[model samples]
Target: MMRTIMAIVAAGLAAVAVQAAGPGFDPRALKAVAGPPNEVMVLGTPHLSGWPKDFDAKALGPLIDRLAAWKPQSIAVESLSGLQCDALRRAPFRYAETVETYCWDATPARQATGLDVPAATAEVERRLAAWPERPTASDRRHMAALFLAAEDQGSALVQWLRLDGADRHAGDGLDTVLVARLETLRQRRNEEFLIAAPLAARLGLERLEPMDDHSADRPYRNAEEEKAAGAAIMKAWDNAATARRKAADAALQSGIKTGAGVLALYRAYNAPEQAQTIYDSDFGAALKEPSPERFGRGYAGYWEVRNLRMAANIRDVFAAAPGQRMLVIVGASHKFYLQAYLDMMHDVRLVDTDAVLR
Candidate 1:
């Protein structure tokens, strides 16, 4: 009986080894045979909204300068597209919380333009299809209003910023209220507003693509489950790795008074080692929690799904324009997953974030 069992185990091991070494289809292997490969730079950023109220937008100038030099043909920000938000609104049963948390109400803009989300989105496509080589200030103002009606504040800001200051007033489909809103968005602390929009305008790009995803968001079964899951995850995060991460972030943030300091913070956030550090402190720890409910696994699963969807959204943006240079600005934790997923594309060539920064 012992001899038979040993033989069975050996056969199982051999089968596993064979499976691991079997023929595989890797899209990356097709890169050499493809046309000019798409160049992608994934920039990991700390959400500017989380920074101190005293933080100055000018501190980002150096970082913006470097990115502008790279001259990406397309830019993707970590924002939910107006179309996605519209879909979420229709499925309140599954996405009520997500819609509430992430979707902007376009009622004001809708009232201003007499166009709903779908209508406004279609109008945007039509206008861009016929967009001129040199659009007038009036044309820009109209496009900005259309973007607002479509619930795409980031793209609206891109148009607003590209215009001369004299042209950024209430006219050409923009009412006084909508103009005020655009001004407010200009002063917003979010990275999409402060960094991505300005960079797109500076680079002479027409629009910024919103690639964030919240489709995986779901409510807990009950208050008890929610509390239990939160506690378990917190417990997992109380290890030495968490402490080290926090310490490093605090140190970097303390030096953000200067542009060089801000650049340094970005450098640290995008360092190659950050992937392992983040996994150790957050996802890896949650994955190993000892909860019977497997709450940690649930959290990790949601995270992976969200990242995968974000990657897909990004891919969809450059799909029609092969070999386009693209820049993705997202939260630091998402950098590793986005790079890994995007690197699997047949024609994508990942640019070194560190090299770009330098």
Candidate 2:
């Protein structure tokens, strides 16, 4: 009886997946409307400056021009509210401070810091250099995860790697070795969790904006409550890690070969909406920051619930103000999942991020 119930549940999930991704995806639906449709343009944009030889700015100029020609009412960016507190007309930049360096290589940051402009470039170069020629798909996948982790965790990537027991190479060019070690650590620690947010930013039609505040703790008024909250959060993370491991194992067993397949497995089994809530979760003075509730639940509650709220808010906001061309800039990882949510709603037209980005 248990097996039968499990089989039926699995069958239902498979049906949902097919309905979400397969068929009914009309290419014509991607075209620009007489005006912006009820839906916002979700563009998957790349924050990195350099693309492999085939993906240079010269290659992207035409695409940028096309988007500009489309003339969005406003190009919503991924900036923190505080950073963009200035009046909209007075706002100097459209892109968030986090993504400000997209067009050119490290410009003002490098120059102001007096660091070699190229030297300050992300060690992706070093990683690319250290890699074996003609890296396998797994190697590329691992590297991608590492690079992304380094970006997400910032300096924590290196520190956490050492904790993970990956040997720190201490030979010549220690910086490169350290970077590699950190990347390896990120790889081990599960960096895909970090990529979804950036991925969403890239796909959103307009510039990105910081939708959440991710500040760390300062002197707390209530230390006891803080400690208790911290403990609770840690416990939640432990649970999430367990679930994530089970999900990974299931994916491997299921022969989920491609990235999309893995993501689908992640969504179907782990529930991305919940995962995103973990990302956006906030703790009060006692808790501090977003915590993966399953593992630690510090301040960030269940992501599934938060994602649902965000989607509903987005949907309602659109519905509340009808006939307006709205562009919602969210993380790329949320792209597919949000589309699934949007699809379930009525009087809405979903625009493909691919059409806008390409």
Candidate 3:
């Protein structure tokens, strides 16, 4: 009986070994050569204030320099792709608005590529349809240029990547094309001008990836309840943290000309205390929306939907290749949730912003 038991155990071990070696797999060899695990650092940031705040784009230079020093392979931002030209062709009405939005301010692309929105849209569709297995740098340049004309920076971004890694250079027409669109781009209301896009340019990255999801906007079931709940929440925010938060933001914006000032704000913004206090005070506090119970829960649910979607998008960046460093620059309110969901991922290792700030 003992001999039979030993035999069965040995057989099980052999089966396991065989499974591990299936189809040219080499467990030890693969492990030895595998690159480092993917690392992500989510930088919690205040969205640049518009209007009377006098958000000087040049003030963010120090902050941009620090991020460029981090040397990430790809940078993902909170934006979306442009040309779903393929999908739009199949269902024009469904995507008519998208084309219109991209086309509305696509003057820079028209000036550069001489293609209007409809013309640029057709070119994107045509190019993508006949995309080659290996696109030449010239081929990529034209496609990237065309996507820019269509105002699909996200789609234009992918075309930019099609070039050889070393061939991605600034003022190559595609990279520099958006430079001319800077003033016009600011009206779009994003932090891209302040940090993300400029940092990408400095780092010689092909394009920025937008990972924000808005598919599940406002999940609250009761409108009357939601309105009341929103009011209560706003009152709490205004009553408690409004003055202090605004002061800090003002100071940071004013002093960002220096690296020391930027680093101080960076460290403070990413502090655990700040995250905990905000979560406990704002998102955690419950009040009457429709019913006291339902409103808070609904708000939390919507927050979860947004963060989970954002987290999934970040994860997708590392799906094809691990060991890539990604930095997610999002609203400070989103930092804790993004970190929480991303931490749960098996292959994801969250880099300590505290260390980087130091």
Question: How far in Å is the alpha carbon of 317 misplaced in model 2?
Answer: 4.9
Give candidate 3 regions above 4 Å deviation.
1-34, 51-54, 83-144, 149-151, 154-183, 186-189, 218-226, 236-254, 257-259, 286-293
lDDT of each residue in 1-358, candidate 2, tens digit only: 9999999999999999988896666543453545446756654332322212222223233444444544443333332232222222133343333234222222222333333323322444476557564544344333333332333222223223322233433322234434454455433312211232223223332112223222221222366766765676554445444566457546543533344433343334333344443333322221433443322332234343444554565666566556655445454445545556666666466665445443
Pairs clashing within candidate 1: none
Q: Return the TM-score for candidate 3, rounded to 2 decimals.
A: 0.65
Put down candidate 3 lDDT per residue, 219-304, tens digits, no spaces.
34467766787776665555345566677678766665556666677778898778766665567654333454565666677778
Worst lDDT run of 10 residues, candidate 2, spans 189-198
Ranking by lDDT: 1, 3, 2
- Candidates in order, TM-scores: namely 0.95, 0.31, 0.65
Best by TM-score: 1
**Candidate with better lDDT, 1 vs 3:** 1
lDDT of 2: 0.40
Q: What are the lDDT scores of the predictions, listed in order?
A: 0.93, 0.40, 0.67
Count of backbone collisions within predicted model 1: 0
The 10 consecutive residues of candidate 1 with the worst lDDT sum are: 28-37
